[model samples]
Target: MLRRVRRQVADTLRVGAMTLYYLARGQRQRGAVLAQMFEVGNRSVVFTVLTLGFLGAIITLQAGFQALRIIGDTSLVGPQSLPLLVRQLGPTLTGLMVATRVGTGIAAEVGSMVVTEQVDALRMNNAPPVDYLIKPRFVACLVMIPALTVVGIASAFVAGMFTAQAAFHTQPAVYARFDVVKLSDLAEGLSKAVAFGAVIPIIAGASGLMARGGSAGVGEATTRAVVYSSLAVIVLDFVLGGLAFLVFA
Candidate 1:
């Protein structure tokens, strides 16, 4: 088990490094990157918005209810939740969504290619699969995840404001306070977004590259990609959040 884990980790790191090297050299196919951006960003916008919006509304309603019960006032609910939403909920939830949606798509696509020997054909032609397959997706994710995070944050904040206004009779001005947020908070959130984006493609692509067997292998790789990518996002959130607390506290 430990050996298997070690090998998977090694493969992931290797793929990540090669993808970064290609990206740094600007060796990616621009059209492929643009297509992936559309896939990662445009296709994901409505899902991200709807999911985060409902989550924000639910959270605000619960928080306001609790605050009203405890303190006879719900005015602070929005102010308090805003920082949490900006720094944690926005990026983390978006990362999870991407991990499930984009990660699975990447893995399935590459794994299918592997099972079909398409990757082997590329190798036969002396073409690096990492440069062609992973780099474009890596670039796209890096660009799009932060943008998605921002969209998610705005959606959630607006939803929370409306929920608070309707549920607790709180004014929009009070529910939309930004004074509690700081540069560090924004930095922390965006940092997590970028980090999650960087890992998703590399991990998913690595899983696909390691696929074996046949159709079953592709399925296994897709499942592994979703699980590993989601785990990476959660672990990164904890690590980055801790660092932010220690540094910015």
Candidate 2:
């Protein structure tokens, strides 16, 4: 058991070292990385925007109704509810969505490549597979996830505003309380995005790299990557949420 534990620890350290090394040297392949990032991030923009927009509309309408009943005035709902959606719910939901959507794709793609020996082909050509594969995805997801989060927040706000203004007849300025959205909230959202972005791709890509056996192994790795990455995002979200309260409270 001790020997097995030591081996596992050693393998983890080795993987960590390799991941760091590739990340450090990733800049050399900036063009490829940027291209991949654009493809991955941009491709997913439509879905992210649509999903967030719908969510925002739903939250706004529901919250507005509840607030109206409590205070006998609908306008109070706009101001009271926007902050909760933006500060608490928006970023967390956006990060998780991106993780599940794109992170799984990364893992499955890389895992398939490993199983098919495509990664070996790159290595045979003196191309480092990590540099060619992992770095671009890592950089892309990290950069794009935040952008996606921003889109989600904006969509949510716009949807909320539309629902409040059109459906409930709330005044425009009632929802325009920019003062409520503190810099601390923005920082927390950005921090969550960054942490999530860093985590998902690494977990997915690493799982793919570690895949053994044949097609079955690739499939298993792909599944594992998605599961592991999703769990990591959730755990990190909680940790960041707590930290956000401490830092911003």
Candidate 3:
């Protein structure tokens, strides 16, 4: 069991190193990068908007309720909810969403290529699969995940405004007016997004590259990719949050 664990860790590191090496050299298919970025960002917009909007509304309602009862100020919800969402919830949730959706998609696609021996064929043609496949994916995830997080965070505030008005009769601009989300909060969130973005594609693409045993293996690879990347996001969020607190607290 320990041997297997060690092997997995070694394999994961090898995959990351290869992908990073390719990323440093720049991409061969500029179109591929743009297509991937569109897939990662544009395709996820509705999901991000709806999920985050409702979540923001729920948070606003809860915070407003508590503030109303204790301090008789629904506007206080802005300070409690916006800062928390911007610094932690926004990036973490965004990462998890991308891991589940985009990570799984990348893994499944790559795993199909593996199961069908397309990757081997590409290599036979003297094409570097790592540069062609892994690098673009890594770049797309790193670039787009943070952008998606920003969109989601902004939408969440809009949703929170509606919820706050309904629950507490608070004005819509109360959140911004209070200056609750400092620059540090935004920085922390974006940093978390960057960490998560790196985690998702690297793990997913590596899992796909290692796929074997035909179609069943591809399915398993897809599942493992999403699971591993999601777990990585959660662990990273905890670590980054702790580091942020240590530095900023």
Candidate 4:
């Protein structure tokens, strides 16, 4: 178990180093990066919005319920939910969701390429896969995942407002007093976005690059990518969340 863990960590570091090396390349591959950005961001927006909207409703209902018991009114929901969502829920959920969607896609795509020897074709053509393939996905994931986190937070806020109004009689006017998106909170959330964004592609790409066998290998790599990326997001949240509290304190 320990040896396997160490091997995985070593693999992750090597892939992460390659990601960083290509991340600094100039605009020669801007088209690839932009294409990946759209795939990672625009294509995923609808799913994110819908998911966060419902999640916001559920959170608001629960917050309102608890606040009602303690404060005799659910008016506190507006101010309370934003801080929790923005500082914790927003980045974490966005990371995990996108890891499931985008990470698996990345893993399967690259794993298939590896298994089918398509990566070797690129090499035969004198094209480095790191530059032509991994860089775009790495850069795109870093940029777009944070943007998705912002969008998800906004959708949740809007949904929370409606739900709080309908289910708890906590007037829409309540959000007028919502002061939770403070600079400190924003710092925490954005920091998490950055960390989680970086985590997905590195781990997923590492798994894909290591694919063996054939179609069975690709499937296994994809599964490992999802599992590792999901776990990384949670573990990172725990570590980064602690540092955020200190940094933002």
Whose lDDT is greatest here?
1
TM-score of model 3 relative to the true fold?
0.92
Ranking by lDDT: 1, 4, 3, 2
Quote the positional error of residue 97 for candidate 3 in Å: 0.3
Residue by residue across 1-249, what tens digits does model 3's lDDT show?
677446555766888898878777745775888888998888888888888888899888878777778888876777678888988988988888889889899999999999899999988976677888888888888999999898888888889988777777787777555466788887789899999988888888888887898889999899888888888899999999999999888
In order, how many clashes per candidate? Answer: 0, 0, 0, 0
Greater-TM-score candidate between 1 and 2: 1
lDDT of 3 at 232: 89
Q: After superposition, how far is residue 117 of candidate 4 from its true place, in Å?
A: 0.6
lDDT of 1 by residue, 90-206 (tens): 999999998888999999999999999999998898668999888888989999999999999999999999999888899999888899998999999999999999999899999
Candidate 2: how many backbone clashes?
0
Report the lDDT of model 1 for residue 39. 91
Q: Which pairs clash inside model 1? A: none
TM-score of each: 0.96, 0.86, 0.92, 0.94
Candidate 1 residue runs with Cα over 4 Å from true position = 25-28
Question: Rank by TM-score, descending?
Answer: 1, 4, 3, 2
Maximum-TM-score candidate = 1
Worst 10 residues of 1 by lDDT: 21-30
Query: Model 2 compared with the native: what TM-score?
Result: 0.86
